[model samples]
Target: MPRFGEDYHHFHSQPEPSAAYSTSLSSWAPSEQQRSLPPPRWSSSASWFVPPTRLLALLLLLTVALQPALARALDEEGEGSGDGGKGGDFSVDMYHIPKPFQFVETPRDMQVIEERAASFFCHTSDAAEVSVQWRKNGQAILPSSTTASAEDVPGGSVLTILPKMKDNNATFECVAENALGDTISAQASLTVYEDNANAIPEGFPQFRLAEMEEEEPDKFPVFWPLAIEVEPDVLEVNCEATGDPEPKIKWFKSMRPLELKNPRYSVLAPGRLQIKISREEDDGTLYSCMAVNEKGVVFSGVFGLYHLE
Candidate 1:
């Protein structure tokens, strides 16, 4: 009911709010019980909202939990691929291993004419990686005389020699070697004969001896004992003799004179005979040599030639 002027003056005269009163009215002034209570929960619609850091932490936990399962799945897929996932173009053959050298064909004993070329042949398996060496009389021969053919597969090696009489009975062997081991071939021998001993005599003509002043006792030709069993690729026999005059010799097979014109048969001076290639027909055949001169005639012991098993 006061006048307007008086009411305005009274409102201006009222005191301003003090710091203590403001503190008492502030919403931050909470009691002990309210402080002990949990914070207020958000509304249901807003409950799904989460801080970025919390979301990231949950994702990391999920990843760690699934790691073992992912690894197992990858391992299973690799096994199903059939190569165990070794990958990157690497390969291995577990079943096969390198092998040692082995002989296929061994050299054979041979007889060659004097001053002629002699050849020997030998073969081995796994030739590509093998190295061949020729040995004679237990000494290594030079490689210049050796020739190898068919390098990529099992093949043969040839040894050629221009032989002399000194080479008679020379033993030769072939050695093939690889990373694994060496293979030694059986021994082979060379028998060399003089060309003059292989030459054929001309015609055998009858001759008369001139009378001498002093009469001498006639010395007939004689032969030593011959081998009972002879087996060789080439048949060779010598009919040695002792006589007053040099004796002329003739060879016979099975009681018949050998075909002198046949290329396989060779007759040399005094009495060496050779059959180039002995055949099955030559088996069990008897061979003999006859010697005749002005004084007398003689027959050598019979010999039977056979083939080796």
Candidate 2:
């Protein structure tokens, strides 16, 4: 043991080991063949002894076993010593991505026609493959002669339909969708106008005149082939309304509703109600006119009839 300790010192301090020392150690060392032989069995009395290397290895293993538990204990104690709110605080861990999609309602300015029609404009940040369909009373529109089809629009899509072609009053809808999600617009009513040519002002567009004939006449249908002539100073007004359920017309002269009994006025037809007011009196004035059925109302463009005379 003394010799081995002295040799370890010389290995670090001396310049180098001579080849003679190597030769002497090689001659004294056991050969690989001899070392491979089984170690001699230890007696019961010798079993108590442990090699220094084995003792050191055991000590290291024991230290490793205690370290993790000690670390956990220190962590627990530190956490208990501070604010409870800070103890459990952690960053938000998002688990899953959510779908993105939204909807915009159809413009109220749209005139409801014979066929049901509403449009939903979809807005979304994500690009997606989308499909939109309209359903009424929870029934899908199928391939049919009168059934309206779904059309694609920018950033989304729209579905149009004639919910019930036979009945002038069917509910309509607009639906928009994309791969991420779907959105729906509220129900709307359709107005199927039947043409009563006599009821249309004679000068009104030919297409609109045809609409009056579509429905059975409720009252003596009247038509105005020639809209009454008006001077530049006069404000001329005419109105026509249609609906599954018949629509009514209300006229306002300036801010007040007008009575047709005046000698200056004549009611030629039910729908072709006309009004003439001198521009010298009514210029720069705003008038409100509305057409209404059970389902809804449509207001007309503001009319200004006169300038400062």
Strongest candidate by lDDT: 1
Q: What overall lDDT goes with each candidate model?
A: 0.58, 0.48
lDDT of 1 by residue, 58-164 (tens): 99999999978877776777777787654323345698776555677777776554544445657776657566777899888864543211121235466656677
76 in model 1: Cα distance from truth in Å?
17
Which portions of model 2 miss their true places by more than 4 Å? 1-100, 107-127, 160-165, 182-185, 197-309
The TM-score obtained by model 1 is 0.32
Candidate 2 TM-score over all chains jointly: 0.29
| Model 1, residue 5: C-alpha shift (Å) | 99
lDDT of 1: 0.58
lDDT digits (tens) for residues 1-309 of candidate 2: 234334445445544444434456556654454455443443423536678899999999999999788667766766887874355443567788764565544523223333322232333333566565655545666647366655554454444343333635555554656664555444554544333335323222221232232356542233222234466423245666565466666554443444468755555565554446655545565554555554544444445544443
